[model samples]
Target: MTHLPLAGRRVIELGTMVAAPFATHILSQLGAEVIKVEPPTGDTTRALVRGGPSGTFIAYNHGKKSLSIALDTPEGRDVFRRLVASADIVIHNLSPSATRKLQITADDLAAVNPRLIYCHIRGYAAGPQHDDLATNPVAEASTGVMDDHRIDGRPSRLGPSYHDQFAGAYGVIRILATLLQPAPTAEERRIEIGLYETGLHVAARDLAGVQLKMQLLGRPEKEGGGEFSMPGYGAYQVNDGRWLYLLVLTDAHWQKLATALGMPEADDPALAKLRERKKQRERVEAAVRAAVGKLGFDEAAERLRAAGVGFSEVLPLERVLAAPQARQPGKLRDLDYRGLHFEAPEFPGQAECSPGLPPPELGEHTVELLRGLGFDERACAALVEQRAVAVAREGDFAWAPVRPEASGKA
Candidate 1:
C-alpha cells in the first residue's frame, strides 16, 4: 500500500452531524490522525436511531477516534485547548453562538497554535441569514436548490444531504490548498465555508447553462424566463412501471435512441438537425415515451443496450448495491469493524486504503488519548470522575451482532 498524503498529520474534529464529520472522514481515509471530539452525550446522530449509531453516523465517523468531553466545564475547555495546541488542523461545524459558548472558535484555537489550520463549516454565510439551527435540508430549501429540483411545481429535496456533503468536499479542498501554500499567518489560517454558497458552487454548470440561455434570449435570468432546456435526456416509464433514464448528448446518440425505440421519425427531414430536434422537444419526448411505454422493462432494457444507448434502470438502493459499478474495489469495500461485516464506500484515488477501523464508541479513546497527551493515569481518572470527560470501561473495541430477540422478544 502507498503512503497516504496526510499520514503524519493530526486533526481535531469538533464536529457533529454530517458536514464536519464528512470532512474529517476524508482526512482519516487519507491517513490523517483524526480525533473526533464529541460531547459526553455523544454525537447527536448516535441517538437518532434507537439502538446505536445510525448509518449516517457510522459512514461519516469511521476511521477516527472519539473523545467525549463536556465543553461547558473549565477542565474540558482546558483539555481541548491542549489538544488544539498539539494538532495540525481543527475543523468544526458548530453554530456561531455554539462556538462562542464553547470558546472553540478559529480565533480561540489560533491563539493556542498560530500555525493551526482552523476550518469552520456552517449552513449559511456569516451574516444575518445564518440561522443557528439551520440543518442540511433547511439550507437546501433556503438556497433555492429544492426549487430547482422541482417536479411539476412541487419542490423536492434530493435523497441525500447534498449541500452538507458538498460543503465537506469543498472544506477538504480548501484545507489541502491552504496546506500547500506558504506558512499561513495567524489571520490566514481561518477558513469558512457555508452550505448555501457551496450549493451555488455545485450548481455552476447548470447556472452557466441558465446564463447562456438568458443571454441568447436577451432576458434576465431572475425575471421568470431563461431555462437552458435539453431534449432526449430524461427518464421514461415502461409498461412495467420502471423508469429508464436515457442520455442522448449528441446527434448520433439521438439517432441511436430513435432507432432503439423503433420510432419511424429516424429519417424525417424535419428532425435531421440538432436544433430542429430540440425545437420539437415535446413531440420527440411524447414519441419516445409512447415507444418506451409499449415495451416491458426487459425488452426496453435489451433494446437500449443493443442500440448502444446511454441508459439505465432507475434502480433502488438494493439494486445499486448489487450493480457492477458499486462492486469496483475502490468504489466499495467490505469492512470487518470489530465483528460486524458490511460494505462501506471508499473514496476514489485514495493512496492509503481504509483499514476498516470502526468508528469509536463515545469516549472510547478518552483514557488512551489523555495518557498519550502526557497526563498520568491518576489525572485521567480524576477528569473522568469529575464528569468533565467520559471513558469507556469495557474493551476498546467490540461488535455484537444484533440478535433478532433484541428487537422486542428474548
Candidate 2:
C-alpha cells in the first residue's frame, strides 16, 4: 500500500460537536494520527442519542484516538502540554473564555512547542462579535444564508450544518497549506477559522449579485434571494409521488427535455433562446408539470436518461443510504461500535482505501497514550484517581444496534 500523505503527522484535536472534530477527521483520513482531547465526560454529541453513538458523533469523529482529560486540573494541563510538545498540529473549537480559562490557546501551547500549527475555529473573526456565541444556524442567519433559503417569507435553516462543514473544510485547507511552508514561524503557524465567515463565503454568490445589481443597475435586491428564476430548473412531483429536480441550463438541454417529454411547443423558434424561455417561464413550467404529472417516476427517469437530460430523484434522508449511488462499491466504510455495526460514507477521495481505526470510545486510549507520554504506571493511576483523566470502562459502553435491520449483512 502507498503511504498516505500525512502519515507521520500528529494532530491533537480539542473539538466538540462538529467543526473542529470534522477538520481533524479529514486529517485522520489523510493519514495523520489525530488525538481527540475531550473532557472526562466525552464530546457532547456522544450522548445525543439514547443508545449507542449519535450519528453526528459517528459521522465526524471516526479514525481518531480519544483522550479524556479535565483541563481544569493541573495534572490534565501537564498531560496536554506533553502531548503538544510532540504534536504537529493542535485544533479546537472551544470558546475564547474557555480556552483562556483552560490555558490551551495557541499562545499558551506555542510556548510549549513553537513548531505546533495551532488552529482555532470560532464563531466570528476578530471584531465586535468575536466573543459572541454562535452555532450553525446562528452563523447562517447572521451571514444571510438563512435569508437566502427562507421559506414562506421566514428565514429557514438549511437541513444540514453546511457552515460548520465548510469551516471544517477550510480549516483543512489552511492546515495543509501551512504544512507546505518550510519552517514557518510561530506567528505564521497560528490559524483561525470563523463559522460566520464561512457562512458568508457560502452565500457570496447571492450577496455579490445583490450588490452588483444595486451598484451597476440601480436596482433593489430581489425579495427572495437564491431562488432560481429560470423555468424547468425546479422540483416537480410525478404520478408516482417522487420528486425529480430538472435543470434546463442551456438551450440544448431545453430542446432535449422538450423532445423527451413530447412537448408540442418545442417547434417554437422563439423558445430556442434562454432569455425567451425565461420570459415565458410560466408556460414552459406548466408544460413540464403537465407532462411530468402524467408519467410515473420510473418512466420519467428512463425517458430523461434516454434523452440525456439532467435530472435526479430527490431522495429523502431515510432513503439516501439505500440509494443506488450510495450502495456502490467503495462509497461507504463499515464500522462497528460496541458490536453495533453500521456504515458511513467514505471521505472524499478516500474511496476504496483504508479508513484507519474506528472512533475511540471515550478515553479509550487514555492509559496507552499516557504510557507513551512517559508516565509510569503509578503516575497514570494517580492522574485517574484525581479525576484529571478518565479511562474507558466496560460499563461505560452499551451494545444497542443503531440499525439492526442492516446488521450482519454486507
Candidate 3:
C-alpha cells in the first residue's frame, strides 16, 4: 500500500467544538498521527447532544488519539510540553485569554520544538476585539454573512457552521504550506486564522460587488437577494410534491429548459436573450411553474436530463446519505464507534489508505502514550492519581446509532 501524504506527521490538537479539531481531522484523514488534548472533563462537544459522542464531535474528531489532561495543573503542563517537543504541529482554538493562561501559545511551545508548525484559530484577528469570545454565529454576524443570507428581512445564520469549518480549512492550508517550506527556519512557524476574518473572506465577492455598484451608480444597490436574478434559476415543485432546483444560466440553457418543459410562452423571440428573459422573469417563471406543476418529478428529471439542462431533485438531509452520488467508492468511509455503524465522507483527494481508527475515547491512549514518553506503568498511575491526567474506563464509550425506521424509505 502507498503511504498517505501526511504519513509521518505528528499533530497535537488542543481544540473543542469545530475549528481546531476540524483542522486536525483533515490531517488525520491524510494519515497524520493526531493526538487530541482534551481537558479532564473532556471536550464540551463530547456532551453536545444528550447522549455520549455527539454528532458534532464524531463528525470532526474521528481518527485521532485522545489525551485528557488538566492543563491547569503543573504536571499536566509538563506532560503537554513533553508532547509538544516531539510534535510536528500544534493546533488550538482556545480563547486568547485561555491560551495565555495555559501558556501553550506559539512562543511558549516554540521554545520546546523550534521546528513546530503552530496554528491558532481565533474569533478575531489581533485587535481590540481579539480577546473577545466568538462562536460561528457571532463571527457570521460580525461579518456580513448573516445579513447577506437574511430570510424574511431578518438576518439568519447558515445551517452549517461554514465560517468555523472554513477557518479550520485555512488552518490546514497554512500548516501544510509551512510543512512544505523548503528550508528550515529559526523563526517560529506560527499561523493564525480568525473566524471573523474567514467570514469576511467568504463574503469578499459580495462585498466587492456592492462597492462596485455604489461607485458606478452613486447609490447603494437595492437588496434583492435570494440567489436568483435570472428566471428559471431557482427551485420549483413538481406534481409529485418534490422540489427540483433548476439552473438556466446561458441562453442555450434557457432555450433548452423551455423546449424540454414544452413551455409555449417561452418560445417568444423577445425572451430568447438573457436580459429580455430577466425583464419577463415573471412570465418565464410562471410558464416554468405551470409546466413543472403538470409533470411528476421523475418525468421532469428525465426531460431535463434529455435536454441537458442542469437540474436536480432537492433531497433532504436524511436522503443525502443514500444518494447515488454519495455512495460512490472513495466518497465515504464506513466508521464504527462502540459498534454503532455510520458513514462519513472521505477527505477529498486522500489516497485510499488503511481505515483510520475511530475517534478515541477520552484519554484512551494516555497510558500507552505516556509509556512511550518514558513513563512507566507506576508513574502513569501516579499521574492519574494526582488528577493531572485521565483515562477512559471500560464501558465509558457508547454510541446510539440511528434507528432504521427513522431513515424512512431511501
- The TM-score between candidate 1 and the true structure equals 0.88
Q: Which stretches of candidate 1 lie over 4 Å from their true place?
A: 126-133, 208-228, 296-299, 337-339, 351-354, 393-410
User: What would the per-residue lDDT of candidate 2 be over residues 193-311, giving only the tens digit for each residue?
Assistant: 99988988888887888898899889966534222566777788999889999977788988999899889877889888878987897898899899889999999999999999999
Q: Which tens-of-lDDT digit does each residue in 296-382 have in candidate 3?
A: 999999999999999988989889989887777777877888767878788876445357788789999999888878888898999
Compared with the true structure, all predictions reach lDDT values of 0.81, 0.86, 0.85
| Best first by lDDT, ranked | 2, 3, 1
- Leading candidate by lDDT: 2
Question: For residue 197, what is the lDDT in candidate 1?
Answer: 81
Residue 151, candidate 1: alpha-carbon lDDT: 68
| Candidate 2: residue 260 Cα off by (Å) | 0.8
Clash number for every model? 0, 0, 0
| 201-235: candidate 1 lDDT, tens digit per residue | 77676577668868898763542212224466788
Sort by TM-score, top down from the best: 3, 2, 1
**lDDT value for candidate 1?**
0.81
